[model samples]
Target: MVKNAYVHIPFCKSKCKYCSFVSYPQLELTKQYLEALQEEIKYFYKNEPLKTLYIGGGTPSVLEVSELADIIENFRFDKAAEITVELNPETLTKDYFKGLKSIGVNRISLGCQTFDDEILKSIGRRHNSEQVKNSVELAFSAGFENINLDFIYGLPSQTIEGFAEDLKTAAYLDVKHISLYGLKIEDGCFFYKNPPEKLPDSDTQADMYLKAIEILTGKGFEHYEVSNFAKPGFESRHNLNYWDNNSYYGFGIAAHGYVDGVRYSNYQDFDTYFKFPHVHFLTHRVTLKEQLEEEIFLGFRECKGINVQKINEKFSIDFEKKYSQILAKYTASNHIQKTPQGYKLSDEGILVSNVILADFL
Candidate 1:
């Protein structure tokens, strides 16, 4: 049964230089896009109660409070479902946050990529550090108690000391969730052609990560996932669906979904997607072998790693018989370990997780 849903709104006030996500600056499409989105959800939503709902992308809060309310009212959500909306700091208004809360949104994810003013300008984000502080206060003023603040590290000219200060300030911000992402020079992004200078070297970036981890965990945040930290019970339920390998419905250009062991994505090009305004999507199915491989990869991203028994039960495979050879190799190397009830990565395994995960794939 489908339990999670993601809606991508491909409109942003201004696109970031480092982002390669499917988003545009054409704000005029707001009305028609919302209508088209509503039609698509009406067609494929199954009207089933949902466990989680996430409104992401270009910048979900770019819409007016009324528009966001209209978009949310169209869905059939489960009681006490974890409903979330990603907000850019500049677009966060008190009325907007309250409107979202009134429509059952319980979580707000603010894309505060960094707290440094110079870095914010360099990244082309119009919002500054004070804007983030004010926006978060607006959310709390709207009675939003569950808030997530996202940040990035390893930026051009970033120092471990600077990021440490950010961490300390963030811990003092009274937020319950934090997501830390490393900057990557992605294709199609401006950074790919004009890469930033003085980006932390690989070794320095690793040290920055270690330092941030030390600070955050000390402030009582649990490092639940590789790049995410949360106070008790504040983990992102929408993302947990992916790590748990559960089914979710994704809508909008470039959005991807996994249903019934099949994975599919809507066309990436907005112009191409606009042609099929009302269609939920065209999709391709993933194989059982693919599922097993993905489970190993995404599962071990969590600190707990994989649950061998659970994998066996879901995919109907004997954990040992299926990969006795693979297991022997990694187990001997101490990359994987066997527990009383399951298998998981050792501490060293998590560090080189991609290497081990790629082998399984």
Candidate 2:
């Protein structure tokens, strides 16, 4: 029924060094871009009364409250809908949070990469640690109960201790959710061209990730997903929709969607996107084999891991027999462990997840 949707706001005041996402520092095109987005939504959106709508971007906070409200008004949401907006600390204010609340936004995900002021500058982030704290306070004051703080573990000049402190501070702020990611200097980011010094090694990053799990869980957060931890009832429903392999609509430049077993993405280039806003840049109908692989890959991302019974029934294959060798190898190594429902990756397994998941592909 496509009860979930993701809208991309491609404009940012400036680019972050480690970000390679399809975003631009072109606020001048905001009006035109929004118009194009509306056109696309009008053409494709079926108004299914979305259960979750996530507005993500180069920086969605760059837009005015009224503008963001206008975008929200276009969608028909369920009564209990989870509408999330990704914001930068520097661009938020108490009034801004109130405006978002008035327009039906129930969740706010703040980009607080680190608490170290020096590391913040090295990564080209516009806000500092204090701003992050202030923004969280303002959000809470504005009556937002579901707040998420994002942190990167392996940034330039970032240390394990510093990252642990960042997670602790987030917990102290009483946010509902936290997402941690290892830094990947992908192509198209500034770091790709001019690599920063003092970057942590892979092993260090792994340690930082484990440390985060320890700190957050100790604070009564559930490590529900590999990269996400949340208070009991505060997991991100929009993102959970993705990990569950459900269908959704994607709007705006570079946004990807999976609908009716077909995965599609919009154009990344501004010129191309504006010209063909209603047309998808690429579409691939998922094959059964690919779908099975995806189910395994995505399911394993969760802390609960894959349900072998469901997989066997859905695909009509013997889960153990088909991948007996792989399962035995990982199980013997204690990297993959069996659960009442099925199996999940151990902490060490997650460290080498790429290598493990690749074998399934």
Candidate 3:
């Protein structure tokens, strides 16, 4: 069953320097874009009540609550479905928060990349540190208990101490969840064209990540996923669905979806998407070999790790025979800890997870 869905709103108030997502600052295109999105949803949605729904952005909060409601009304959610929306601090208001609850949005993922005023401007984020604090307070006032704050480490001019301070501040706020990311200069982002000076080196970034794990775990948050920390029962169900390789529907321009072992993406261009929003521009049928690789890579991302027995039985292959050499190397290095269930990345392993995960592929 396709019990998870992702709705992409490809409009932002302004583009952030590090963002390469398909988003535009033109408000005039919103109406037409939304109409096309509705058409796509109607044509593609399988009508199963969703167990989790995530409305991600450009900036979903840039739209008025009424407009957001129009989008939400199209879906049939399970009785206890988790519905989340990505919010920008400067875009929220008390009324908007209340309206969000009315439309069944129970989770708010605020993009508060960092708590430094100068860094905020440097990254092209419209909100300042004060706005971020105020936004969280306002969300709480509006009865939002399941709130998530996003933080980025290794940013230009960011030090290990500075990133640690950000983690402490997020913990003090008492949010239910947090997501920490390392800055990458992806092609087409501003940093890719004109790289930022004083960005932390890989070793420094590793230290920053370790510090975050220490701080957040001390604050009673569980490191549920590689980049996500959450209080008990507050883990992101929609995201877990992805890690579990469950099928889902993705609607809107540049959105990607995986359903029944085939991955597909919508056209990125506005004109192309608007012309035939129901048609996917890219589609790839995942092979059994690729599926095994994904199952390992994605499952290993969780703190609990992958179930070796389950993987072996599901894929009809002996896990040990297939990857004994890979296992021996990492296990000998203490990068992977063998658990009763399976293998999970050790603290040392997580610091250089990309290198290890790439080797698995």
Candidate 4:
């Protein structure tokens, strides 16, 4: 049974450049979208005991506080559920957050792309450095103890010193969580045509990433995942569910779901996503081979590598039997260790993880 769920609110005040996630400008469709979302929960979940509830979005805070509460109230969550909502810092207000607290949203993942005003507007973020600061203060004042601030490194025109400054400022805050992201430019956004000048070199980006991992780790924060850091006991439970290959119900346009060994998503277009009167979900069961592929891919995303013993035990197949040649290649090269507990990537292997995951595939 799926015990965790992710609800994607595909509504943004305006789209950000370099973003390809399925969300649209929600200027007038907020009410209708919430209704559709409620119908979605009612139709699919039938009210299970959700251990973790994540309300991610183009911008979830776009909804009125009351609308946000009504959306959150649709679920029956666990007593100590880790309920998180993604908020654009610009949309937050003091009153908006108090209602959010009352409605059981205990975690706020604020998108504070960069503390520098220059970088903020360049990336099309609505909030400036001060607004970002104020929104975090607003949430903290309203009794939100768990907050995750997101910032991107390796932006088109960002410098290493600028990136470090942003991290230092956030660290100075009493915030318990940080999510660092690397910028990826794609088609259909401002970056596609007018990609910024003097983008950070791959080597520089790697250096920046390593610097962040080192700095955050030394600051009493655990580098639990490639892009996430947390103080002790504050690591994200909802994301851990994904890395562990546990099942979850994914709702909204372009949101992905895994249930009963199946993986699928609804159509990406908003018109199609909202055309249905009631909740609509589509399922595509994974072939056993596909499931195994995903297990390897997702597990390696964490600092803790995959457990070979568990895979062999659960799948009832020898790792050597399935991929003897691949295992021989990496093991001989010292890219992996066939440990008693499991197979783990070597230090060199962690940096080239994409290449490692592709080896099994």
TM-score of each: 0.94, 0.99, 0.98, 0.93
lDDT of 2 by residue, 1-361 (tens): 8999999999889999999998999899999999999999999998789999999998999999999998999999888999999999996889999999999999999999899999999899999999999999999999999999999999988888889889888999999999988999999999999999999998899999999889999999999999999999999999999998889999999999998889999999889999999999999999999999999999999999999999999999999999999999999998899999889999999989889999888
What residue runs in model 2 are displaced by over 4 Å at the alpha carbon? none
Task: Kindly list the per-residue Cα lDDT of model 1 for residues 1-361, writing each as its tens digit.
Answer: 8989999999888878888888989998787778767777777778778889899998988877787777777777778899999999985778778888888889999998889999888888879999899988999899999999999998887889999988888789889999988888799888888888888887787777778778999999998888889999999999988898889988777788876767777876656666775553567787877778888788877766778888889889887887888889999999888877667777566667778877776
Residue 249 local lDDT, model 2: 95
lDDT of 2 at 312: 93
How many pairs of residues collide in model 3? 0
Highest lDDT: which candidate?
Answer: 2
Write model 3 residue lDDT over 188-213, tens digit each, in one string.
88889988888899889889999999
Models ranked on lDDT: 2, 3, 1, 4
Worst lDDT window (10 residues) for model 4? 273-282
Q: Give the TM-score of candidate 4.
A: 0.93
Q: Quote the positional error of residue 42 for candidate 1 in Å.
A: 1.2
Q: lDDT of all the models against the reference?
A: 0.83, 0.93, 0.91, 0.81
| Ordered list by TM-score, greatest first | 2, 3, 1, 4
Candidate 4 residue 283 Cα shift, in angstroms, is: 2.9
Candidate 2 or 1, higher TM-score: 2
Comparing 3 with 4 on TM-score, the higher-scoring candidate is 3
Going through the candidates in the order shown, the clash numbers are: 0, 0, 0, 0
